[model samples]
Target: MLSLQLIRDKKEFVAERLSIKNFDAANLLNEITALDKTRRATQSELDELLSKANQLTKSIGQLYKAGARDKAEAAKSRSAELKEQTKVLSAKLSETVELLNKKLVELPNIPHESVPAGHSDADNETVYEEGEMPTLPEDALPHWELATKYQIIDFDLGSKVTGAGFPFYRGQGARLQRALINFFLDEAIDAGYLEYQPPLLINEDSGFGTGQLPDKEGQMYFANEDNLYLIPTAEVPITNIYRNVILKETDFPIKNVAYSNCFRREAGSYGKDVRGLNRLHQFDKVEIVQIEHPDNSYATLETMKEYVANLLRKLELPFRILRLCGGDLSFTSALTFDFETYSGAQKRWLEVSSVSNFESYQANRMKLRFKDKNGKMQLAHTLNGSALALPRIVASLLENNQTPEGIKIPKALQRYTGFDLIK
Candidate 1:
C-alpha cells in the first residue's frame, strides 16, 4: 500500500508515474481525496463537540453548586445533544476511512522509473543470456513423452487421484525432485540466508501482507472454511515473517529462505503452454527473501539476480534474464527480472525464476520497518526471488540433456541425486 501522505502531497506525481503501468489513477485519487477531506472534517467536528460537552459538564457542576438548577439542566440537555452528534459523526468518519483504504489498496504499485512501457512479455527487455542450447536428434522427445518412456512421471495417475495439472513423479523423477530441493536449500544456506520450513497454508493477513490477497485471489487456492490460502510461493509466507516487525539500522540486510510445496489455481490456463511440466497446480520451489535499507536495496536486487543466474549456470541450463515490462510486472513488484531457461525439446524459453525489488511497496503494506540512525522509523525495502522452481527446471534438464542412452543430470546436482543419469 502507498503511504496516504504521499497520495495527499503528490497526487499528480503519483498518477503520472502509475501511467507507466497503464493505470489511470486520476479518478481514484479524486475520490480518495474527497473521502479523506470528509473523514478529517467529521473528526474535527466530533472533537469540537466532545470538547464542548466536557466544558458544559464542568459548567453544569458549578451551576448546581451555586443552586442554579435550571441552568444545570439546560447544560445537561446540550451535552446530551452533543453526544448524539458525536456518535453520528464518528460513524461517518469510520465509514469514510474504510472506503478510502479500500480505494488505496486497489491502486497497484508504481513502476520503477527504469521500467519500460509495454503491454506484454514480448516487449520485455532481455538483459543477459548464457549457456548453450543443446543439440537434439530429430526423435528427441518432450519431457512429458520422455517421462513416459522412462516411467518417471505419471500424468494419468495424478489425474485419477486428483485432477489435471497435478502429476506424480516416481522412481528417478521423484529422486530428482528431492535432490533439487536439497541442492537449492543448501545453496541458499551457503549464501548467508537463514532457511525456514514455513507452513504451506497462510492466513488472509499473510496473503495481504505480501500483496497476494485481493489482487491475485483468483489465482490462489483458498480453504474457504478456514479463510486461509494455499501458498502460491514460499515467498508469501517467508516474507510475511517480518510483517508488523520493527528493526534497528543494523538489521539492514535481513536474509531468509524457504523451500515449500506451492499450490496455485491455474484457472483459464490451457493449450501447449500448460503442457507437461510447463505449469502445474502443485509445484516445489526454493524462495529467497531479503529486507534491506532503502539505500542499498537496488544493489541488493542485482546481487539477487546474479545469485539466480549462478544457479542456472551450475545446472548447465541455457537461460536468459529479461527485465519485465510494466504490464507484465506483478501488482506488488516495482521492478522484476524473469529468468527463463531454454527447453530444448519444446524449442522455447520457460520462466524458471523472477528476481524482484519491491522497494517499499510490500514493506509499507507489511509495516516491516526499521529505525534509521536518526531514530526515525521508515519502511524497509523487500526483495525476493525463486532461486529455482522445480517443474520447469526439471523440464529444461530432462529435455535439454536427453541422449540416446538416458537423461544426464547436471554435475552440480549429482551428489544430491546419487546418480549421474536417469535411465
Candidate 2:
C-alpha cells in the first residue's frame, strides 16, 4: 500500500515512477488527495469541537463547586450537544479514511528508475547470458515425450484419477524430483539462508502480505469452509513471519530459504506454451527471502541475481538473464530480473526464476518495520527469488544433457542423485 503522504507531497514523483511500470496515476492520485483533504478537515473540526467541550466542562465544574447549580446545568446541556455533533463528525472521518485507504491499495509499487520502459517480455533486456545452448539430435523429443518413452512420468493415470495438470512422477522421475529438492535446499543452506518448512495454506492477511490475494484472487485455490487459500509460493508464508514485527537495526537483513509444493489455480493461463513442465497446477520451488535495511536492499538484489546465475552455471545449462520491462514486472516489485533457460525441443526460453526487490512496498502492507538509530520505526526493504523452481529445471536438464546412452547428470548434482545417468 502507498503512503498517503507520498500521494500528497510527492504526487508528481510517484506518478513519474509508476509510469515506468506502465501505470496511469493522474486520476486515482487526485482522488486520494481530495479524500485526504476532507479527512484532515473532518478531524480538525472534531478536534475544535472537543476543545470547546472541554472548556465548557471545566467551567461547569468550577460553577458547581461555587454552588452555582443553574449555570453548571446549562453548560452540561451544551456539552451534550457537542457530543452529538462529534458522533456525526467521527463517522465522516472514518469514511474519508476508508476512501483514502482504498485508493492507496489500488496503486501498485512504482517501478524503480533503472527499470526499462516497455510493454512486454520482448522488450526485456538481456543483462547477462551464460553457457551454450545444447546440441541435440533431430530425433530428440521433449521431456513429456521422453518421460512417456522411459515410463518416468504418467499423465494419463493422473488425468483418470484427478483430471489434467496433476500428473504422476514415477520411478526415476520421482527420485529425480527428490534429488533436485535436496540439492537446491543444501545449496541454499550452504549459502547462509536458514531453512523453513512453511504451512501450505494461509489466511487472507498472509496472502495480502506477499501481494498474492487482492490482485490474483482467481489464481489461488480458496477453501471456502475454512477461509484459507492454498499458498501459491513459499514467499507468502515465509515473509509473513515478520508481519507486524518491529525489528532491531542489528537484526535486519533476515535471510530465509524454504522448499514448498506451491499450489496455483492456473486460471486464464492455457494454450500451447503451457505444455509439459512449462506450467502446472502444483510444483516444487526453493525460495530465498530477505528483509534488509533499505540501504543494502539493492546490493542484496545483485547478490541474489549472481547466486541464481551461479546455480544455473553449476547445472551446466544454457541461460540468460532478462531485466524485466515495466509491463512484464510483477505488481509489487519495483525492479525484477528473470532467468530463462533454453529449452531445446520447445525452441524457446523457459522462465525458471524471478529475483526482485520490493523496496518498502511490501513492508508497508505487512507493517514490518525496523527501528533506526534514533529509535524511529521505518519500513524495511524486502527481497525474494526462487533459488530455483523444480519442473522447468528438470526439463532443461533432461533436454540439454540428453545423450544416445541417457541423460547425463551435471557434476554438482551427480552426488545428490546417486547416479550419473537417468537411464
Considering summed lDDT, which 10 consecutive residues are worst modelled in model 2?
1-10
Query: Alpha carbon lDDT of residue 345, candidate 1?
Result: 90
- Superposition error at 240 for model 2 (Å): 0.9
lDDT of 1 by residue, 102-163 (tens): 89898888888889999899989999999998999878899999999999999999999999
Residue pairs with backbone overlap in model 2: none
lDDT per residue for candidate 2 within 1-423, as digits (tens), equals 777767788999999888888899989999989998899999999999989989998999999999999988998999999999989999999999988877888899988888999999989999989899888888888988888877878878888998677789998888888888998899889999999999999999998887886878899999999999999899999999999999999997689999999988898888888887889888899999999999999999999999999899898889999999998998899999999999887778999999999999899999999999999988999999998998899888888778888888899988887888878
TM-score of each predicted structure versus truth: 0.95, 0.94
Clashing pairs in 1: none
- At residue 325, give the lDDT of candidate 2: 91
- Candidate 2 Cα deviation (angstroms), residue 359: 0.3
